[model samples]
Each structure stands twice: as structure tokens, then as C-alpha cells.
Target: MSAVEAAPRVEGRSNRGTATWMVVPALVLLIGFFALPYLTIITMSLREASTRAVYGEGFTLAHYTTALGDFYIWGILGRTLLIGATVTVISLLLGYPVAYHLAKSRSRWTSLLYIFVLSPLLVGLVVRTFAWMIILSNNGVANQALKATGLIDFPLQLMNNSLGVTIALTHVFLPFIILPLLGNLQAISPDLAMASRSLGASRMRTFWKVTLPLSMPGIQAGTILVFVLSISAYVTPAMLGGTGGRTMSVLVVQYLVDNFRWPAGAALAIIMAAVAVIFVGLYLRLTARAMRRLP
Candidate 1:
């Protein structure tokens, strides 16, 4: 065979070897960091705590039953899900347009737009939550301006409630939604859009049919990110929500810290992890199915 023919086989073998080597490190890390910890937590969740011991060594489903049996816990879970859903919808509504704008615009403007979207991440979450607290406080700038303009008879109660948590979280995670969305949008070649337009489709129709479908991966990715973060969020909800809109994470912290109930807290943590995994798996499967249908 010619050298060129031999080169293909050699290169294929090298690539396979490289991939195999790469996977060893990944497997090691996953086993040591992710898998082992997950197993430990699951084991811990199955045990109960005793007053004399840190945890009762015996296996029992009592902790799970106790945690799941509470109506208040379910209410808190429902509220968390509501917040996550609301945040996700709002993020998509807001981020999709920004992503489309960034992806379709001239390449020169992309860096500036990315910086603008991601700048908020530079600040700490506490700082951002506190800043929102000030903005929505009864005497804060937002209320003051509204009162100044006579928009309302009284200051809007934006702080210490779900509204405050939602607003802060939306701002906090906007970049996560925007970046993935922009990536998906940018990956779609402009030729597709141009070709659709050439076929006499209106801009709106072309976007609805072409751009949006192509960008579903990003939209799904951002949605998962926003939802998971919103569900597990503690700082924003704790600072802004208080008792009125407490999340599961806040309750988990309370159980662990205030009540000194490790087993219950561990059970809650396991549930949160399971929820996150399920959400991610569903998202991946949906995205994969969409991709399979595409071409």
C-alpha cells in the first residue's frame, strides 16, 4: 500500500489510544470524587441519627419516610419548583432574544455583548442579593422612585418575598442562560436562514421555524441550568424570601444546622441531587431526540 493509505490506519490507531488514555483519568476522577461521595451520601440517608451517636449504623428507611411524609416539606418543594419554573421561563424569555441578537450580529460586537451579559458574575452572590434587597426595600431607590413618580400610593413590597428572590436569581443566572443560548444560535449557519428567506418566508416565520428550532439545545441547556440553580438556591431565598418563600435548600440547611438532624439533612441533600440528575437526564434525552429528528 502507498504511504498515504498506511497513514490513515496509523492515525486511527493513535486516536483510539489517545481516547483510551484520556478516559482513564476521567474514570479515576469520577470514581473517587463523584461516585464514592454519592454512595456515601445515599448510605447516610438510609440511616437514622441517635442522641448518643452521630448516626445510627443500622439500615432503615425511616429518614426518607419522615422527610417525605411531611405536608410542609411537600409545600416547600412545590414552592421551589414554582420558583424554578418561573425563573426558567423568565430566563428563556429574556435570554433568547439577547442570544439571538449576539449570535446574528457582526462578529466585532460579540465580545462586548458577552462581557455585558457576564459582568454580573464578577460580583459575589451575597453582594448581588444585598444590592437587590436595597433596590426593592421599602425605602430603597425603586420604591422611592415609584413614590416620587406617583406610580403607587405606597412602596411596593418587593423585598422579603418570592418576588425579591425571583428578581435576584434571574439577574444572577442570566449569563448562564445567555451563554449556552448564544453558542447554540451561533452554531447554526446563517446560510440556513438566508436560504429560508430566499424561498419567500417572512423574517418572523424564518426565525420561528429555523432559528428557534436550531437553538433548542441552548434553550434546553439554559433552562436546566436555571431551574437546577433556582431549586437548590439558598442564599438568595434566605436573604430575600425569609419564611414567606423559603426553598428546600434553606430547609435542608435549617435541619442540618439548627435542628442538628444530620440524617434528615442528608436525606434532603440526596433528594436534591436526585432531582438535579433527573432533570439533566431528561434534558439530555430530549435534546438528543430533537437532534435525531433534525437530519
Candidate 2:
């Protein structure tokens, strides 16, 4: 009885050890790369600013106080949030139709269209931002085309502003929204829409009443992804925004790199991450409630 019982126990212990060893590399990487950096940021955020060094020796809440108290910082935060929301909404509006067509149509060009949508993403972000800068400049293609068409007497101020940043960001992230919506649209059976049509529902009516509701999960996922990425973006904002279009991410970089205020930068980064997490939480709660209300 002792040998039999001990044999199974030993085998069970060996299996458990094997599983633990399998997970150890992942745990080590997470702790070493993510957990340690995030913990360091939290510690840095609570410290005082140092003139002679990256951070001071004493504990202080001054960085948090400064970040929260300053109206300029709040304005940047507000703009970041606003842009993020705007981009998400615009991406949804533009992407949905393209996604629907891609999912439903049997055109020969479908693969090409998909490639076109994703091609921008294949290029580096910095390269894409610089390209936008060229196109949006005063005498660039956009202004030249408008002027040639007699749409305006002068070049539109497209670059170095919020509008430029928003436009570029929308373009950059549009594929993200489209891909998810396409997947969701494809998951939906065509028979539902066809059945509604057979039952005398108009095409538009069937779309609104049947198709749209089923697509909410995809919409929510895409919106959250676009918004989070938009808010956290740094290079696009820096290149297109200049001073007038400054966002929270740009400010974080300024604090850390230009001003050498590590504590302040760390505080700002933490705050930004917190805001994103809170927004995601609230969005998920609201989405769940909405889903529950649906059939």
C-alpha cells in the first residue's frame, strides 16, 4: 500500500515539476522586462526631482501635484482623449462599409483591396508620419490639388495642427478597425439577411435591424483598440502636431528627454496608463450592459 500510493504521488510530483519548469521562462521574461520596468516607474514617480541626477534621493509627491495641478498638462490630456475618441469614431464610420464589402463581395479585386488596406501598416510608423508631413505641407499635394480645382484661394493649414495628426492617425489605424469588422461580418450567416429579405424586409431595414446589432462586439473591440493606440501614440503626434497639437505622450517625452525630469515623466506615464485602464474598464462595463439589453 505504501509503495503503490508513493509511486503515484511521485509521478504526480514529476508532472507538476515539468509543468512548473515549462512556465518558468515566461514568468522570468515577464518579471524581468515588464514587471521590473513598471515597478521602477512607480517608484520613480513618487520621488523628488533632482538637478544633479535623473531623480532625487527623497520621497515626494511633487511630480503628481505638478502634473495634476497644471492646466497645460490637463489640456494636453484632454486633447489626447478627444483625438483618440474622434479617431475611433471616424475609423468605425469609414471602416464598416469597406469591411462589409470585403466580407460579402466576390469581386476579383478583393485580395488586392485587402492588401491595400494593410500595406500602410507594413511601412514603419516614422516613415508614414514623414510622408504625411510632406502631403499635408502648405504647398504639398493636398493644397496643390485643392488650388488646382479652385476649391480655395490659398493653401489650407493642414500641417502642424490637431487636424493633421488626426487624419494621419486615422489612416494609420483604419486597417485595425477594418480587419476586426471584416472578421465579425464574415462570422454572421448570410441566411439571416436573406431570410429577412424573403419575409418582406427592405434591404436597408434588414441591415439596420439584423446586421448592425450582430456587429456590436466587433465594433467595441475595434473602437477600444484604436482609442488605446491613438492615445498612447508618440511619433505621429510629435511629427505632425508641433506645439499647437501637443498631446500627453509628447509631454511625457519632453519631461524625460528634453527636461531631464525623470520623476515628472514617470508620473505622467503612470497617469496616462491609469487613464487608459479606467477608460477600458468603463467601456467594457457599458458594453456588457448594452449587450444584455439586446436580444
Candidate 3:
């Protein structure tokens, strides 16, 4: 073979080796961190707490049975889903416009916009939760402003409730939604819309037919991220939410910290992880099928 012909085979083998090397480290880390911990939790969930063994001495369906049978656990699971769904919807509504606007802007403007969008990540979650607490309290700035404006005689009930937790979570997770969406939007070529316009399609039709469909990946990614994060969140809900608004994380913390129920806490954590995995898997499958049909 000529040098050029031989080069292809050599380059292909080099690329394959490089891919193997790159993948090995990631696989190792995934097993060492995620897979190992998950297995440990599953083992704990299967075992009896008193014996601290996986089978025979400790093996029982009791932990899983208790988790499934307990009304309080089910209630908190429902609340967590509700809160996560609410926050995900709100984040999508609030973040999509910001993301779309930024994506459509010039590069300089987009860069500046990202700084503002990502600023919240710099602040501690506790601090942000407390800030919301201060603003949403009955005598806080929000209520004070409403009173000053004569919007209501009484301060609107904003703090220590589901509404407050939703708002806070939406605020906290907004940037995650925006960045993913913005990236996805940016990846789409403006030429598609311009081509549609040239073919006499209106702006709204172009958006619906071309832009929106193309942006679905970002929407899916952002929604999954926001939903998972919001559902698993601890600090925001615990701070802003009252008893009625308590989420699965709060319940897990209560079990682990207050109740010192290690096995039950592990069980709750397993359930929470399972829920997140299922939701994300469903989202990915749905989005993949949608994307396959898009063209």
C-alpha cells in the first residue's frame, strides 16, 4: 500500500486506542463513585438494620415494605413530585425566553447575559434560600412593597409555603434550564429560519415548524435537569416551605438526622434516586424518539 493508504489504518487504530483510554478513566470513576455507592445503598435497603448484613441474618423485605406501605413516605413522595414538576414548569417558562433572547443576540451580548444568568450559582444555596425567606416573609420587603402600593390590605401569603418553595426553586434552577436551552438554541443555524422566510413563511410559522422543533433537545435537557435538581433539593424547600410543602429530601433528612433511622433513610434515598432515574430515562427515550422523527 501507498503511504497515504497505510496512514488511514494507522490513524484509525490510534483513534480507537485514544477512545479506549478516554473511556477507561470515566468508567473507573463511575464505578468507584456512582455504581459502588448505589450498590451499597441497595444492599443496605435489602438488609435488616440491627444485623447490618445483606442476607440471612439481616436480609428482609421489611425496609422496602415499610417504604411502600408508609402513608407518610408516599405523601412526601407526592409532594416532592409536585414541587419538582412545578419548579420545572416555572423554570421553563421563565428561562426559555431569557435563553432564546440571549441565543438570538449578538455574541457580545450573549456573553454578558450568561454572566447574569449564572450569577446565582456563585452564591451559596443556603444564602439564597435565606434571601428568599427575607423577601417572602409577611413583614418582608415583598409584602412591604405590596402594602406601600396598596395592592392588598394584608400581606400576601408568600413565605413558608408551597408557593414560596416553588418560587425559590425556580429561581435557583433557572440558570441550569437557561444555559442548556441557550446552548441548544445557539447550535441551530439561523439559516433555517432565514430560508423559511425566503420561501414566504411568516415568522410565527418559521418558529413553529423549524425553530421550535430544532430547539426540543435543549427543552428536554433543561426540563430533565431542573426537575431532577428541584426534586432532590433540600435547602430551598426546607427553608421556604412549611409542613405542607415538605419534600422527599426534607423527609429523608428528617429520617436520617432527627429520627436516626439509617436503614429507612437509605431506603428513602434509594427511592428518590430511582424516581429521578426513571424520570430522566423516560425523558431521554421520548426526546430521542421525537428527534428521530424531526427530520
Best by TM-score: 2
Candidate 2, superposed: residue stretches over 4 Å from native: 1-24
Clashing pairs in 3: none
lDDT digits (tens) for residues 1-295 of candidate 1: 9998999899999999999999999899999999998888788788868878878878888888887898888888888888888898898899899988888788887888888899879898889888888898899989999998989988888978788888888988888899999888889999999999999999999998888888888888898989888888899999999788888899889987888878878898887777778877887898789866864
Q: What tens-digit string does per-residue lDDT give for candidate 2 at 84-136?
A: 99999999999999999999989999999999889879999999998998899
Sort by lDDT, best first: what order?
2, 3, 1
TM-score of every candidate:
0.89, 0.91, 0.89
lDDT per model, in order? 0.87, 0.92, 0.87
lDDT at 145 for candidate 2?
91
Q: lDDT of model 3 at residue 135?
A: 95
- The Cα RMSD in angstroms, rounded to one decimal, for candidate 2 relative to the true structure is 2.8
* Number of clashing pairs per prediction, in order: 0, 0, 0
lDDT: worst 10-residue window of model 3: 49-58
